[model samples]
Target chain A: MNAITARLSSFRRHLDPAVITAFACILLLLFLGSLYSRNFLSPEYLLQQLKVASFLGIIATGMMLVILLGQIDLSLPWVVTVGAMMSSAAAGFGHTGAMLAIPFGIFCGVLIGLVNGFGVAYLRIPSMIITLATNAVAQGLMVVYTGGFSPQDSASPTMRYLATGFIIPSIPNSVLCWIIVGAAAVFLMNRTGFGRSIYGIGNRERAAYLSGINTRRIVLTVFGISGGLAAFGGVLLAGYASKAAQSMGDAYLLPAIAAVVLGGTSILGGRGSYLGTVAGVLLITLLQSILSVMQMPEFGRQIIYGLVIIMMLLLYGRESLSR
Target chain B: MKQWRFWFVEHRGTLMALVIFVVMFLIYASNHPAGFGANMVQTASNKGVLLAFVAMAQSLVVITSGIDLSVGMVFTLTNCLASWLVVGSPAQVILGIIAVLAVGAVCGAINGCVVIYGRLQPIVATIATGAIYYGIALALRPFPGGTVNETIADALTGKLFNFIPASLVAMIAIVFVVWVPFSRSVAGRAAYAVGSSETAAYMSGVPIKRAKFFAYTLSGLLAGTGGLFLTFFTYTGEAAYASGNAYTLFSIASVVLGGVSLMGGKGSAIGAIFGALAFRTIGDLLFVFDFDPLWQPLFQGVVLLLAVSLSAFGLLRVRNRLDWFT
Candidate 1:
């Protein structure tokens, strides 16, 4: 009893309870998964899983920034699609186009993000509605750009190389990309004034304003980063598939939100850690892998996914509500 | 004169929606080759009423300052269920309709219980439940093939007379049946009170839980009505995930267009119905003017942004920057 008490105290001092719980869930899932399939815990399989998780991790990091501000960007689906489609379309041109493909895709996302920021920060439209409207507009434009048909444009060689290629032996470039982004996110959230301002604004806009933070600019920059990250994730997806399909980003929205929340980040904002989000990304990716390994049908998978999220929310969100 | 102004203030949202719908429909009808004929009206009503029902469902929850993202999934689930149950003999059809509606209420009640009793935020709770409901729907109709009773479907969908669409009359009847009674009931008034100010409402001895439960259950029933009509119009049940999401989204837009406040405690379902009508007219307006069908989503988004901006102009009037926090 003494040991347990001491351990929990140290744990509380060093790590968030929600983060610990999530890591515990990840470990528990692994133990159970290995019991079901002997190869589930194998290093090769785990490494492969990390490679897949990189995509969602990239997007979730961006989502985290916005969620930390107590705002949401529902426009992720179309922004992602726009990124993939536009980048691929750009790559359809000559050598110059191929070179600029990646940045161009991300830039498209930034543009939408700015619009989202303008609506939310300046216009004071609720983030949910403004993002939703932009999502629709993006979707429509993409459809018209491709004339409601699947694009003939395929991902460039450089794009393909970035996703499937590895610089160091045994580590995927995609994972490296995720690490770079995650590190940047950590630094921003911990070391930067902008990141601190996000927490302040999220806690209470009036308080933050009184404290002299430029809340609107922060909102715009955060949304812009989110858009760029979503597009980057899309670029990775395009590379993996070697092309983009219609509405490919549709499947990412809920999972991204679920991952961020699962990581113990408050959906209402103002409280969370980047490491928690990382754990969340890993947990979600692993659960999905294990479920698919079990051959659970799509509908069944969906049901379990929803149930798990609710269970997690019930565990943590209850405290926030009561206060 | 003072009483009249007060009444107008109370009904302004609905009135605004009515005017918007009137103007849009007029433009659509004038531009159409069919020239606002009975056939044209029937076709328009058939499409418009589905959204109207969903928007009404949304309005019920929005009035209480809670959102039900699962409303669309309830719609899809009930539609899938209706396809399985709303076929066969007359007795079976009635039973099936009741079952579908019951399931919708159950789904909604689950959402309410999570939000109210479990103390989960409404947005996350409904998103979670929405996924579950959608999963059930997918399991029921994996391939999107189910049948509905053609006779009953035709009666509901067809024209009441040579000049009047049956769907429009039924929508009005539903307005009388659902919205009127709820707005008059104690629970309904409690809902409004809670929405306006929950802490104050609770202090005043309003039955907050009961009011919420009533609102959520009715919201489900209304969405179920939409599902039933969907089965009628399509005459088949397919678990179209995109369509469910679209309906959920569009209903919110319609609610906003109808002058229903996303902030809660304001607006009327009557206005949401017209809002639905106006939103539907966007597509028709495009078709009448020979724009590509692909342009529809962009057009809808632009119009919505403009409307939302018009509303946001209210923010400009605030001299105190802190008021923006509210």
Candidate 2:
């Protein structure tokens, strides 16, 4: 009996309790959703949810990287909008524009991210404020570009195929994109020097700099990469919806932050995993779906969402945040 | 001369914000078709005061080395509540105003409790609370239609006897009534101490938790005032998600431009007020310049980026690279 108890303790030691809790919540949410509707447990619906989650999953991936570096990108909403709007806008030029739409949108996002990094790293400004300013700028630029009207250009065929098509007979293309991105993120965070540097900088930038890490450059690059991923998410969103719309990204900002935090990524930075973020993404998507299925009013859903996040934070995240 | 220099250094941020606003306002006035008449000033003040109150609310929390994302939501929530209650007879309207402010205080207290007692980060805690506040706001006025007492609205939003904006007067009075007293109080000093260094402050037996709680509570009251004024401005209530978010962001910008360091323990609400006025002027400048209103956001962004970047110049003076993090 003692041997079994010791083995259990060892197993618990290897796992993050927050991640486990998040996964458990996801299951609990699934169960709750099934109680609301029998079809909730069905394969097609679950796959559909996964496809939908991939959008947030992608954006949250970028957010996680920034958060790991102990910086935030409040400019995310507009970055996503810029990506979708610019990519779709590019479709107006011709076949080449359509072909380059995806890359173009992602490029626009990366530009914004690089700017965020520059402001945070080189300028030594707080990440929150810099990202906020950039977000306003992006919003302004988009407003001017679209003339306050919704852009007329629709997603290209390739964009559509990438977003909603079945690339592997049964699996979604977007899910596959998420898998590819997630795999890369896992490898980057767990297996790369860059990842270690991010953690190091997040832990203590002064120490990282003293140790010869080019902290500013790493910051800029992480922000840039985060932007690219967010824009890529936008491209997928524009494709799924068939057109880019103004303020489409507005709905995403809090959710992405909440998902990352919920997944046990420290809001203070330096300690989180890609797998935890993945779990967080699914949990948020599921919670979102369940609330909607329960026919809860939008405001009610928001209240519940906020309350739950706070409750969870109180439960587990209270201690790690102080440092 | 040394004494004078110290005085200048102390007020540098506030004076800079004042100068920026003055210069921008002058430019805006000179180019205006109306040429800066009482009516125009009244209009500008009415618009500017809303942000000023919110900025002041933000500055309080920031001075305590914390951020409150819910001020805008509190502003919205109060606006919605005011629409419902700040109507009918004078007695009823007064009661309604009190209730609105009280609710705002409650919201802020909740934020304080979460951050201080619950041991959560201010940013995340406020964001969550902000969501909840916004949800309540949306629930309060699901539709964008409600009524505020027209008499009170007109009186507050309009100019006093043709020259001074009443909204401006109210703001000043509150600054004197609320800010002066708070800044001189032990709690306020504790807030500064905590912001500068929580550990040191605690070791010195400063009232760290109480100071933060005070800052958060007062912040809510200020935001509530902004919301109450919003109802006065529009004479209607709307649960606008974007506008709420925008106000929150703009308040932060105003705080920064006012020279209140996000790093905490510096700057003043007076500077933040001037910063807000200047920020508002940025939007108005485009109008006088004949630029499309569409250009406002882009123009605002460029100006803010430049302004924030100017503060980064100090980094060049650092001899040790490690000092940048601290």
Candidate 3:
């Protein structure tokens, strides 16, 4: 009995209140949304929202890892753009390019991520400034590459299949991709030594280093992962839209960040779970769906989105501080 | 030799920024079709002061080891408000100016409260508030069609006595009125203390909260000044989303270039103002050189990267590896 009780208590201790609250909010939002629109609660409508959210989930997963390290990656905007643009540009090059499109797009993201990581880890610049600079550089590069014209290529069949097609009828390929990524993230955080080190470093970098962790390598690796994931998300977006447009990735940066923070992850790092981020992604997606259903203007949706983030920060941010 | 080296070490960032700005400006002027005449200088100053004011605002919060991403939005919001308010009779214009400035201060105060009392991270808090402010601005001027008092606009944006730029005079006056007094005050010192080490400042009985509040509020006021100037230059209010975000990002670049530490408790607004000027000069340099306008972002990013990397040299000099984290 004592052993069983102990196991139960441990499980309860592991449960994050923020994630629970977020789940509750999701349920409430769904209920409210259904009342507003009869179609909102249907399985088909819900599945579609989940698919849309999968892209953000993928990006936010990378963002979460960086945020867990007490760093940020603002370059996601341009990185996503680069991923989409490059993949499309490559697709126009024929069979080899089409075959290599996805990898090449992801590679673009990883390269930029490498630059971002190098600056933050080796050069000792703040990630915010460095990433912002990289974003500008990426923007400039893309503009020059495109010669201020619309990108000339469409999404390849492989990308279109990955982004828009499904192996199972009703279950999205993108959601399956998210599940794979999400599962890996969970396994990384809960099971792997690297995940433990991420928490340790986030909690206290000096201590983590003194304890003999390769802090710099971990930072670079996470940044690379983040860059790659953001790019992957961008490629999916291009596939969904049929082609990449100029500044196509600008819309995701804030929403990705908002989703991460909403998941009850401490912005200061070292604490948070993928489950929380998952819930955050769902909540934001649902809120967005409802807003769109209500026909709210873009600016109004922006205001509400900003307010929700602030409200969440005030509530959960204080709890973390008190603890 | 040691004293001279110490002084040089302390002022190196600012001096470097100054030299870069001078060289770039000189190159721009020499290459310009209009030459370095009063008209040319006035035009440059008019364009430069908007960012200079915003950068100064950013410097205040940055000095407190906090960042105000909302400065750009506040600038835009105030610009929109000024277009609606800064018109008609002199008395009405004066009232309008005060109201606009007050709104900015209030915005800063809201940020301060959320960050300090609410114990939220400054970056996230400011981003939220920035979005809100931008939303308000967008709502205020959905299509960007509102006018400021033309007389006030011309007087501020135009030159003084056909030689010196009136905008330059206004910039200097604002520095005297705002930056000089704030930097000299006890609260300002407390702000620096808090930034350098908050626990140490608190233990030492520094009014950390008040200092931070003042810093953030003043930051808002400076941004408000920028917004007013933006109105003066454009003669209309626009709530351009891209422009606001660009300003926020560039202000950070300027702050870094100006020798202010992002970690806080170091550098000066004067440095940041020059940083802003230098950054603007870099943009104009491209124009004068006839480089493709598309190349500007790339060049700016490279310059920013190089400037930021300059400060990293000190990290290499530290004897203990642990010092790197600090």
Best by DockQ: 2
In candidate 2 chain A, where is summed lDDT lowest over 10 consecutive residues?
Answer: A314-323
The model with the greatest lDDT is: 2
- Residue-level lDDT tens digits of model 2 in A1-323: 99999999997786888899989988888988888889999999899999999999999999999999988999999999999999999987799999999999999999999999999999898889888888889998999999999999999988899999997987999999999999999999889999999999889888899899999999999999999999999999999998999989988888898889888888888988777889889988988888888899999998998998898888777864443
True contacts kept of each: 0.58, 0.70, 0.58
How far does residue A107 in candidate 3 sit from its true spot (Å)?
Answer: 0.2
> Each model's TM-score?
0.97, 0.97, 0.97
Instruction: State the lDDT of candidate 2 residue by residue for B180-269, as single tens digits.
Output: 899889999999888888888988999998899999999999999999999999989999988999999999999999989887888888
**Better candidate number, 2 or 3, judged by DockQ:** 2
DockQ for each candidate? 0.65, 0.67, 0.62
Give the runs in model 1 whose Cα sits over 4 Å from its true position: A1-11, A319-323
Q: Which window of ten consecutive residues has the lowest lDDT sum in model 1 chain A?
A: A314-323
Residue B25 in candidate 2, Cα distance off native in Å: 0.8
> How accurate locally is residue B29 in candidate 2, as Cα lDDT from 0 to 100?
91
Every candidate's chain B TM-score? 0.98, 0.98, 0.96
Per-residue alpha-carbon lDDT of candidate 3 for residues B1-326, written as tens digits (9 for 90 to 100) = 99999988877778977998899899999999888799999999998999999999999999999999899999999999998999999999999999999998888898889888988889888988998898889888988879888888898888889999999999999999998898889998998998898888988989998999999999999999999899988888999888888889889999998989999998889889989999999877888888999888788777777777777888868899998787
